[model samples]
Target chain A: MSDLSPAALSPGGTIGILGGGQLGRMIALAAGPLGLDCHVFCPDPDSPAFRVAARHTVAEYTDTEALKAFAESVDVVTYEFENVPAETLELIAPHAPIRPGAKSLAVSQDRLSERRFLAEIGVPTAAHARVDGEDDIVAGLETTGAPAILKTRRFGYDGKGQTTVRDASDAERAFAAIGGQPAILEERIDFRIECSVVVARSEDGQAVVYDIAENRHENHILKISRVPADIEPRTAQEAAEIGIKTADALGHVGVVAVELFVVGSGDDERLIANEIAPRVHNSGHWTQDGTAASQFENHVRAVAGWPLVAPHRHFDVEMENLIGHDVDRWPDLVAEAGAHLHLYGKRDVRPGRKMGHVNRVRPRER
Target chain B: MSDLSPAALSPGGTIGILGGGQLGRMIALAAGPLGLDCHVFCPDPDSPAFRVAARHTVAEYTDTEALKAFAESVDVVTYEFENVPAETLELIAPHAPIRPGAKSLAVSQDRLSERRFLAEIGVPTAAHARVDGEDDIVAGLETTGAPAILKTRRFGYDGKGQTTVRDASDAERAFAAIGGQPAILEERIDFRIECSVVVARSEDGQAVVYDIAENRHENHILKISRVPADIEPRTAQEAAEIGIKTADALGHVGVVAVELFVVGSGDDERLIANEIAPRVHNSGHWTQDGTAASQFENHVRAVAGWPLVAPHRHFDVEMENLIGHDVDRWPDLVAEAGAHLHLYGKRDVRPGRKMGHVNRVRPRER
Candidate 1:
């Protein structure tokens, strides 16, 4: 049989990564065992991914020369985050194939584009309207209704660049609070719980959606993710479908994670797709020790054009992120039985910063 | 509780590893997620471990100046192989604490000393005699019985530096075959099967012995290791006891592997201790995917003065080593549903060289 394929990379092939945070660090870590090397390109000199990567290019994303050199040196290009500038992708496009491609990146970068794309795919999202200025806020509220959140259309994460619009009168101040940026207003849905589905898609359209993870956030940062989500089995299946649909729609070649709001409970439970992260995400971290192949490994496999590992989870897992000073408890965490600890090699622990995570695994009861 | 301990290292600590083969490479890989960095010291510039490590020192093992610098730079030191010279350890001892200490290294480096030490610990080994010169081979053969194998006392691995003797008549030829080195003659074991036990020991003397693994060899190199070895429960328990006893006797602070030859069958089955490896052995590689903490991770945890995870078996596993051109089968292996592939980043593929391994995991049967 022929051992060659169009997008398939041999063992020693190099993968170029755009960000150098924990997610990039983990993807790079996962690549090493697969005999794949990584060249991490990031502006920060002290990026965590640099510690484990075979190569690191310390240059701004906008620097075309550095981006070109980095792109040419690798077999394929992938990013850890969604905010990579379009110009950067344009420059790298001539050199290496970028997985999850430009369309997914562009759609996920802007809130308006993301919701519109979700709507176009027949996926259910919250009622939302565009707000370009103070005058548009009233019209946006008229469509979205009161008690909505006015969020910036671009460059927002961790609850930043957003504010609460209690009513029509509160729209002007909320719009001013967000620095008059292009924004979208959405009616706040009082969901029963928050959850996410992580799915990996191969170049041939084969996809593996991990078990939906019920999530809890503190200060708008994901604090914990538990597998075997409390949602009904039907709701879980529906959530996974949303993830696979989003991946197929984007023609994504790597992992895609969709954050959803479970609006009801038991037989009435319904999922509302809220956000799409086109990369290996924190909510899926439980797979590292709970399943056969983690999201990181599947992402690497997908981008390298290898077959995806079906998510065969062996244990019920609860992944807790050690944010900020919470990481100082590593001594106790590492000593705990059944706790699989993964600490990003970040020396400083600032408040709200993700220092590491611990996956607590137990024998599957179901 | 206070986070300070004598041998314990903090999250950002560096571990200085001696030897840079696949074992060292895996140890470095395991350290990454624990927030620890590694500095690999090996003479070969093309060492496989260098790619995954944060720092690499390419220098001769006997270079005291280089060894001293490497030891002083890291919180602790450990070796991936037993052949680390005595003088090298003496120099490094003044700078950093070495795991699987000098005593364990000394015992494992020489075949006679290893057997003698095992005997003193109430372990069973084959009857053997030493031969320092060609003339002594006859006496050694007579003591060990006619058909025997003469193995060098030092620097031997993977069936290298040894020869087999048919009887006393073939003594001179067999002695000459091993370069007339200080050797030991052992009665050829006509055994039912070969197996191994891997045990990890912490600084506090806590030990966790894994289930015995039955091993198969081709061309004297490990070809496969299957966990839940087809041995009686009593025999398996006895094998684990030998592993833990050996580790505790030497005050070993990392992983220890004991290879054993099983003789007879059913009620008469018994174990004959053969060789001891002071580092993680190939027989334990199955743990990477079949268990919560891999042998490499457990070894890192032990050497780092962290707590050890009890051997918690999750799957019945068969780990096959892909030697030389066997790695050319990566395309097919990666596509296999239950196979977890790990390729050592070795660019060359000379015959008998280990290129990678695949762990085939299945649900536990017994």
Candidate 2:
């Protein structure tokens, strides 16, 4: 049964995904056509990814026995989100090769570490300082200025675990708002637009970067991502460079996304790195309908040690996330011509939960 | 969790599939993005569809208990192939609403009934006659004449269960070749090209037809299928009409593929209905990359009782099947820039077995 074939066919193995969310579901869906089966290991029994994956084990990330059994059964492991506990990964690491490795997770999982890593890579970021104690908060505010954002360094996402520090005096209250966790104070840049560069990196260091997607947020959750970002050509190129450089620095295999804030206009337009998602990010979801290949497919390719495709974008697209009750508009979306709808199969209608996305495309203007 | 939603969001339920091949797998893959779960039922323990489907029952079609249990579990039922037995459909019909119906299966499962159905719909078909025994062979041969093909009325696909009769003397020999099963003798129509019109029809009777795809075969098995078939515009329009008419007449609630044989040149060109695949056909695989919504997606749409999209072809596509060892060239196929490859996770490389397909796309010429 073991056919010693090359990476072209993806070796027909099972990809064990750590998180079974929409990202994991999309990845499994892409992996299927490539002859790779996915075994989704998520604690959530109602996880949408479990439907599409070949197999699944419902156990907490901290369950060593379950993690070891799952890791041993698959060829390689990849994740949909970065908050996969360090101990869980450590338990599985010796049994299976985890792509975009532990270091990428360690860095992205913590804001302070992520910011430090960005600085080491020479990527420009918002002015920031770490805050552990009350004195540190005052000291960080002195550097970042009042009205900076106070964010918990760990487990912050979708604008959660963060609050605005109105002033040095208000920093303590903002810190307590995030449960007084270890945090960072960062000077928030006033940017023209938010955009993301999603790049897939192979284990061999080869990379392919997707066009930057200009994003819009509602309640700190991504609402819309449009490609052919409204940015000067140089900024897009620089953003792509940042994505590639960051992935290469982390020895990243699979898709890594860098969210950038376009801070200026015309020649003065420069990008400030905001965050790095160590997996396929929402902004790159546009690629699923805009290009010949998607970030999910590229992630599967990189994770399988296969060749990554340089996909050509065939259309200018606008991808709108179907948050909560927004999925109920699916009928109108499905009926609309040129609208590509993707529902994540999440049955719940939690107010901020991502239910799906619809990508509306128009012919690219040459 | 049971949120009552419109057809637009797909309502998130399990789609019971009656077969577990690449087609079923692709259907499940498409259904996932629409938030529909698939429960594939196949006797093959190593079925490719099992990997993507939410749940699977590896029990034979003759297993009535399993069929009942499977059918009762899903909201609706559909199949990948036409060979799903009459008794199996009868068993499932009571438990779930079957898309493309038992009647479509009955007609397609038998070549004679299929010919009659086409005739009743005012569609052109090659001259054919039924042969149940030796006496009927000579009589049917007399009507169809020399140089005809003897096909068993049931269980025939991929060039199986049929043989060509050279002349009157060869009629009995050809009949014997097919193991003397109840058969239909079809007059060999000299064809300029072989093409297919893949159409999806909703439960409400709305239909959308794809552009005719010209197919090339090797050893009676499909080798290549290219869109924008080498036919006149009027012929393509007529082929699409045939597809719509056939699907509507069969009361189809999913994709139905109508194979056509084009005869003669220019103004004199005409089509003869060759075969009807009452499911997502292999020839329609190009839609995965050539159009926004695929045949599988359309099938998913129809079966879910949702509104189907009128998909516009975005590229000129050429689809080549990866049969058996041809899949071993995955490296080159994966590396090919314009090529979109799909590999069914069938571990063995059996000769003539469809391993996967690749659709190469280029900018559509105006």
Query: lDDT winner among the candidates?
Result: 1
Over the stretch A1-366, how does candidate 1's per-residue lDDT look in tens digits?
434367799999999999999999999999999999999999999998988888899999999899999999999999999999999999999999999799889899999999999999999999999888987888887878888899999999999999999988987799999999999999898999999999999988999999999999999999999988888988998998999999999999999999999997877789898999989999999999989899999999999999989998889999999999999999999889899999999989899999999999998886
Chain A in model 2: its TM-score? 0.97
TM-scores for every predicted model? 0.99, 0.97
Candidate 2: the clashing residue pairs are A331-B8
Single out the weakest 10-residue window by summed lDDT for candidate 2 chain B: B1-10
What lDDT tens digits, residue by residue, belong to model 2 across residues A46-140?
Answer: 99999898899999999989999999999888999999888988999899889979889999999999999999999999999988876777888
Regions of candidate 2 where Cα sits further than 4 Å from its true position = A1-9, B1-10
Highest-DockQ candidate: 1
Deviation of model 2 at A13, angstroms: 0.8
TM-score of the second chain for every model: 0.98, 0.96
Give the chain B TM-score achieved by candidate 1.
0.98
User: How would you encode candidate 1's per-residue C-alpha lDDT over B140-252 as one tens digit per residue?
Assistant: 77778878899999999999998988887898899899998899988888999999999999998989988899999999999999989988889999999999999999999
